[model samples]
Target: MTLTHNRKPDESKTAVLAVNVGKPQALPGQKREVMSGIVKHPVSGPVFLSFTGMTGDAQADLEHHGGPDKAVCVYDYSRYAALEELMNRKLDWGACGENLTVEGCREDEVRIGDVYELGEATVQVSQPRQPCFKLGARYDYKELPVYFQDSGHTGFYFRVLQEGEVAPSAVFRRISTDPASLTILDANRIMHQGKQDSMGMRTLLAIPTLSDSWKQTLLKRLTKLESEQQG
Candidate 1:
């Protein structure tokens, strides 16, 4: 997830290399299993993109995972090798629990509210994917989440605007330009890396395309920061 990259990400257009979906599997309570939907399997051909999620995909933690605002979870293809170098382990496409493993969709240049025509469906960038305990659970590395956040390789989510079929053969092309232009990298920086930057938090709050949960979080943080500054 580090800014250091083994490969430069192409931001012009995105190409789907694999489509993935997963159902929650019951895990042993003592095994650090959070009943996560992070274990995904790649699918071939076309899959229906709905307002909630893919056809077979089901999230164990619906409160944090699924909804209209997070219909699809996408991961940048460039992060795998970069992360592997840092972690010294091999990672697969679906390791990050993303529904779509895509190339040319790096977070540095990707902006919140940027609309794209992905295959037949229309989707807008909603927010950066936040790592939870499940990420460390799946990888058996308790500190992985910390490293992931620091690397700024956090993947992002897309809210589906129009329902349609998405396939591996389709290109995720940017259809509209965002005026607010808040990149996912900066969002992550403000939310996780630099919480004291009230100005950065305000910048993210101004973006109408930001996810509801993120907006509320920033608002609360900003209030707390202001109170602390006043105190």
Candidate 2:
């Protein structure tokens, strides 16, 4: 399926792949720390993979909850002109909520179900956005949810199909497609109250944490809907 957008694809985009390490003397699983690096796609796994506007503020809250050095966003790896503009600022940090600061590649080009190849790993786009409580405290802008809703860049999450170490300068590419009909954005929209009736059962089955009771209840409803769709 072709993903249509008003803008052309920018293949030179860059981003970061930051992991969480507790402390200076700790391993990866010990604690959470944000590191810097370059990446091709923003929504792949082993990275924070958060959206643009609210992510900076949300990172602060995550740090407060767990560690002070929480990794936020990976940088925007698509626009060179925008990247240069941001770099010209005298600020010591490269915006907040970004563990992996990226430049060059076309992030917006990615639709739901798109697979990004990050060296030894393959990341599959999962849900659209996970708006959590951490957001409210980060910006103190109680309406962050609305901000995400309005702005379309609600970043995508990725499931790790293959595990491997990623670095700042690592290269990434695209891989295969499963149920090419689904998209991360569309799935997320469906997950919301809008197009729930149109989502595929296979996609719904992938969400493991979606409570058994809720799943069963939804299953019953979906069973009826499936009959209707088939009819």
Candidate 3:
């Protein structure tokens, strides 16, 4: 069950292009304040990442975002091209509200509990980011969240293992991976697409590396399903 990538990550292949952080701001045409750090600009020097998130980053909605497990939002640089094609427009690196715009690793390659040495900081993959309606609001496209979810290109989050500074062009080296084969992509599928598969849900629930928030949400869904059946 231990899956290993025998090859080391090539520094030239994997790198951080931008480190962006933002505070809460009022969305255009909306009265509510949203901490949609999606419009991040590149920082020239090292930025510190703590257990919660990048030093300057803040989340307005604590109900769903920004905790130890949901900290350090990461998006693949490769997916930008696909997203641009879908939206038929050019987008910036931090357009997805990611703290780090990363290259080389994609959702499929990153598994839950996979740890990486990112610059001076160490981070572990926590879960696939569930796109929210705020994304659509940011783009002014109401269907964007649905499109993002269905595209399966949803970026992932990281839990800071070792708080340290990270700069642009920093390389990420995979330190280790969980023995369970539940990848971020697989976890996303189980959460978003495989609702009818009770067996799959049970198996996902058993994985020790799965995020506690995700487990709780799945448990609620299962309970609701059971109640409905009994009703």
Q: Best-fitting candidate, measured by TM-score? A: 1
What's each prediction's TM-score? 0.91, 0.48, 0.88
Root mean square deviation (Cα) for candidate 2: 11.2
Residues 77-167, candidate 2: write the lDDT tens digits: 3332332243342211222233444433233455445566764555554444444533333334445545444443344445555656554
- lDDT winner between 1 and 2, please give it: 1
Candidate 3 — which residues are off by over 4 angstroms? 1-12, 31-35, 227-231
lDDT for each residue of candidate 3 in 165-223, tens digit (9 for 90 to 100): 88887767788987665777788888889887677788788877677899998998888
Clashes of each: 1, 34, 1
For candidate 1, give the lDDT of residue 5: 37
In model 1, the Cα lDDT at residue 49 comes to 93
lDDT for position 193 in model 2? 48
Q: How high is the lDDT of residue 150 in model 1?
A: 86
lDDT of 2 at 92: 18
By summed lDDT, the worst window of 10 consecutive residues in model 1 runs over 1-10
Per-residue CA lDDT of model 1 for 123-200, tens digit only, reads: 999999988877877766778788779877798999999989998888678889675688888889889978899999
